[model samples]
Target: MTALRPAPALLEAAFEAAREAMVLCTADRVVVMANEAARHLLPSARPGSPAPAPLPADGADSFQAEHEGRQLYGMRRELDDGHHAWFLRDHTEELARTTALEVERSRTAFLAEAGRRLSASLHMRRCVRTAVELAATHLADAAIVVLPPERRQSAWTRLLPGLPVEEGTLREPQLGEVPGLLEALGGFPPIPSRWLDPSQAPGWLVPAGFGPVGALLVIPLPGNAEPAGALILARCGPAAVFTSEDEVLARIFAARAGAAVSAAVLYREQVDTTAILQADLLPPELPEPEGFELTGAYQAAREGLRIGGDFYDVFGPAGASTDTVIALGDVCGTGPEAAVLTGKVRQTLRALRLVHTEPAAMLTVLNEALLQQSSRQPRFVTMVIGSVHRIDHGRVQLELASGGHPAPLVLRHDGSVEEVPTSGTLIGVLPRTVVRPATVELAPGELCLLYSDGLTEARGGPTGTEQFGEGRLHQALSECRGMPGAVAVERIRQLVSDWVRGGDSDDIAMLAVRAPTRTPLSLRGGGAPAQSPYVIAARRGDRRPRNF
Candidate 1:
């Protein structure tokens, strides 16, 4: 049997009781029919205004319509009668919820990406720029990062290991600006981020090409106790203005960005401080005397950027050109205490230079000074103090004295290396010293190298536990004859560095002095050359400060 279709009256009753608004309009824009819900929902659907267009065949689009100043979302369908049937629902709430969820997701992801970008560099400016760019891309049309003056305390605030302990003064605030939106923001404070009402925004804001609507947020960047900086975000009119929720998210982002930027600031300050401290602890440029070529290298232990106690210096007597002094010494230990003792030892030796003519006598006086000083902890020092005097055109005499230190190496004019046989009790270890001067005359193309035990004692090899022995040092220097003083020093430095493979090691200090193969042309001529032609002077590139 065939099923009977529903009567027209039954269909009409069902349409009137339906929840969705329904309307039937002829193609020419005249309403042919309407349900009670449709009439109540869209009063204009009763007759002609303009018929809503039919929905896309794929049903992938919705049209927004306004009735009674309320927003509506619906679709239109083509009926068999050549008319259009419009089906609409009150979607304002659902659309609001979905848009909110999407925005929330975007914000979460943006913050995560911002964190990654901010932490990617230890540079302060880069971190600030990352934060501003991220805010502009996700939170607002424009953004700004403003930093307060740097704190005065040591940059050792961060608890993380492997960070440098540096200190630097930040005198002015730093600000980061977004690419656009200056017009909307107008004039911002030079050092701080502050909010402004749209109506009262500075004159430049609107003229600067900021968007239609104006809303601003100034979120203070949180630090350990006080704020390190502030973040400013702005939006134009008609756009979703700043809401309390937006402010909350902005504050959260500002907190993380602040931490990263603060850390970067601390790191940069520490680096600078470390450089200054090392400069003070290490010898300045090696003195360039007519008879000698000098170069040196120093490396601090891996603990941090702070300088260790190993020290070296080459200085000439006040006005005497014929004789110069060379000193290399290591205090009993490392860290600030050793550094202090190193400085004291250097000062004591410098003062003793005037009174003592012999290297052995000078060291005897230094030993007494070391033993007399009162410190929280007792310290001893091993040192080699030598007096270099020009004997003739092609020869130089080195009078050396050692106190419990490695014997200085001599790379002779011939392809041979020998250690100066000098030894004595360590300074600060005995009431009387046993140092005696050991004199050796250096022919042209010979070098006298004094170094700390750090080089020969660095432990790393195939098994990662072998000490770099004097045998290796001897063999290495054997090949360095006739080389520039700077080249010879660098060869040893590179060799030790490679052997250690960047592993933990003690401080390394080296000083090499050579009698040039040829007398400086300036000495032969009437006056000194404008610049030394020695490759030793040219390759003296190690003077550039080391980064820890």
Candidate 2:
């Protein structure tokens, strides 16, 4: 015989063998039939009893409930004769997976937020405070951060839930008060959180009135090449405790905080170094109370640097009749490389002047001294060295020599500008370099300007490519005829700055020496002689002070 179909009544038996729990209920809400699965899924399900409290209300068909300890999910379908069949299955594993997924997402978001807030600042105080605040809000009731020691003392900051942050430095001896803290600061292997008794925390580590301590952890802050600091986290109450996952997170956060703090420290050190170098390279006090009134200006080619290759110094005896040497030099290159040579050349000239005070003779000795440094790179120098002396009340004589430097310009009181004819071989270049001494004189109320080529070689104009040139400088000097040395130097600098129009420039250095003009005493009412220039400066209506 062919395979015969099961009778309609056998379908009822098929329902009994189903894996999911099935129940048949009457219109009166009484259970008519309960399968084996239903009895195992919900212990309360039985024949002739009210269908499990819910029975899938008026228009809805699906429901879920906790029967005993198992989760049951069910749905209802209408059947013939005012009867209904309810089907349910256990879905505890699926529900558990969904909850786990949500938890992972939340943790990922927390880490992302931590990174964003920590990277926002390069300041140590802000970074450490941020780290502790974040840790307190998420990981613990209170947090503390300790920085590596600079000498004998280390800095630390603490934060409690309701109190203001407290920070101070602690000595090395104080570190022994806490267990595992010194090791953490040393970047030793992680110490298990369980080993430290939270209840026994040091008074200094935890703020006063912090009740009970239930958990404690210490982690090292990582840096570029070494440990930058350490982080401490604590919680209150016996129920609060740290897990392995929490320790990993703390280490990661500490690393980020440490890097930011170390970077800030590095930046501060670099700024301090630059400031010291700037102070050292700046021109010192010029030869004052001497025959000539001197004023100088200097600018570095590099944007942030204060000194390049150009330098100037004046050294000698202090008297109107005595000779004083004025040396302004330019090294072969630019920036630090050239600036290095500038210092060496200046120091050599300073020491040699003790033996040879004569202008040309001192330069020759300086050349020889520089060449003797066989270890140094052979860098050439262009300089104007002059021995100045006040010959009379109205004139100052300058015995000058050039070492392949720009010719000095004299701005006469008649509004005339002329360059002194002085030229020679470059200094510090050859074993035997030629130097010739030349003499010039500055009349009262007149200036003799010595400048580096940076003043004339600046490239900027209508097209931003043309040099300022000597012709323009000559015309500019003419307008400074009667102006004092300081005023003339400032005026020339302003002109050059304007010509460049914010373009990059080489090191510009200018030294202007002017002979004081003698003014006759013109008293107002035959009462008192003329007041000094300094006194005139204090009075309003009086002209600007000068080298009178």
lDDT of 1 by residue, 315-379 (tens): 67755445788999888777777887888888788777766456788778887887888876779
lDDT of each: 0.70, 0.79
Q: Which candidate comes out best when scored by lDDT?
A: 2
Question: What are the per-model numbers of colliding residue pairs?
Answer: 6, 0
For residues 1-548, what per-residue lDDT tens digits would candidate 2 score against the true structure? 89999886797788788887888888776888878888777667788877775455564688887666666788888897689888878887788888878877876787788888888877768877888888888778999888888799999988898988888999988887777889988988667788888876788787568877888898888776877788888988888788888887777777777787777667677878877866756676775855679899988888887779998888876434367778888888899878877878888877767665677777777788778877557888899998777865446777778898998988876787877667778888788878766676676677899999999999899989899999999999999989999999999999999999999888888988888875544523344433322111111324433343
- Candidate 1: how many backbone clashes? 6
Instruction: Give stretches of model 1 more than 4 Å off.
Output: 1-99, 149-195, 203-207, 210-213, 224-226, 237-240, 300-306, 319-322, 332-344, 351-358, 361-379, 429-433, 460-464, 494-506, 518-548
Model 1, CA-based lDDT: 0.70
**Candidates in order: C-alpha RMSD to true structure:** 11.2, 7.3
Q: How close is candidate 1 to the true structure, as a TM-score?
A: 0.66
Any idea what lDDT model 2 has?
0.79
Off by over 4 Å in 2: 1-141, 159-166, 209-212, 270-279, 285-291, 316-323, 369-377, 389-391, 521-548
